[model samples]
Target: MAATEQEESLDDLPPSAKLVFKVLEYNGPLTQKGIAEETMLSARTVRYALERLEGISLVTEDVYFADARQNLYQLTEPAEEFTASDGEEATCAD
Candidate 1:
């Protein structure tokens, strides 16, 4: 989807999901447990937040090589997508 669409989708999500997204954006890929710890949210809440993010295609899940039993979550867009030629990062609401 377009960036505008993504922004709109993100706006529609609950605050918990938005927090989770921001945490991932700043911390890079992490396991569900890591997300919960970073956000200070419960595991169940983090799971729901991840679900919402995945539903919007904003997040992707992959096997965590270090632990096959767990999965790593990360933003779909690379860091470069949020960076301009001049090296400024895009705002979340932009």
Candidate 2:
């Protein structure tokens, strides 16, 4: 898909979700706390946004260790398509 088209798809997301996407886009995989810290969002807010993004297949959660309570999140293809270029960083604006 074209960059413009991909970007348009992301336009529907809320600011918090877009912020989470941006943080992941630039910093690689991060745990929910990491996202919250980077975005200055509450942990609960970050988790809520991540859950919404996950439902739309824009983000993925992977359990790094069975004993760990939190999972790391990475952007899915659609997210990368819109928010990254050739693995280079991209920014999302509110």
Candidate 3:
């Protein structure tokens, strides 16, 4: 039997992975070392979290122009943050 097409949400990821995701979401692109330092996680742990995020297609990996030896990590898109005027509820179309 084959697996289903259902996808996992951010809540399904581990705490470390969630921290890594948030770090990237706020700080923009960063290298594995940078993420490790920012998240205060061990290199091995960061690598593991990154692998999980990659598996879920949450974060993207790109070659670092300044240093080819490292890869930069960033979110696929901006985090879901929107502010409405006068406390109005925002819509997707707005």
Top candidate when judged by lDDT against the true structure:
1
Candidate number that wins on lDDT, 1 or 2: 1
Clashing pairs in 3: none
lDDT order, best first, reads 1, 3, 2
| Runs with alpha carbons beyond 4 Å of true place in candidate 1 | 1-8, 78-94
Looking at model 2, how many pairs of residues clash? 0
Q: Which candidate ranks first by TM-score, i.e. highest?
A: 3
> Per-residue alpha-carbon lDDT of model 2 for 9-92, expressed as tens digits?
456778999999999999999998889999999988898888778866788999958438879899877555466767777877
Q: How many clashes does each candidate structure show, in the order listed?
A: 0, 0, 0
Stretches off by above 4 angstroms in model 2 are 1-8, 78-94
- Distance from true location, Cα of 68 in model 3, Å: 0.2
Which scores higher on TM-score, 1 or 3?
A: 3
lDDT (10s digit) by residue, model 1, range 55-88: 8889999999999999999999766667777867
C-alpha lDDT of all candidate models, in order: 0.92, 0.83, 0.88
RMSD in Å for all candidates: 6.9, 9.0, 6.0
Instruction: Report the alpha-carbon TM-score of model 3 versus the true structure.
Output: 0.76
**RMSD of model 2 against the true structure:** 9.0
Question: lDDT, candidate 2, residue 58?
Answer: 80
The lowest-lDDT stretch of 10 consecutive residues in candidate 1 is 85-94
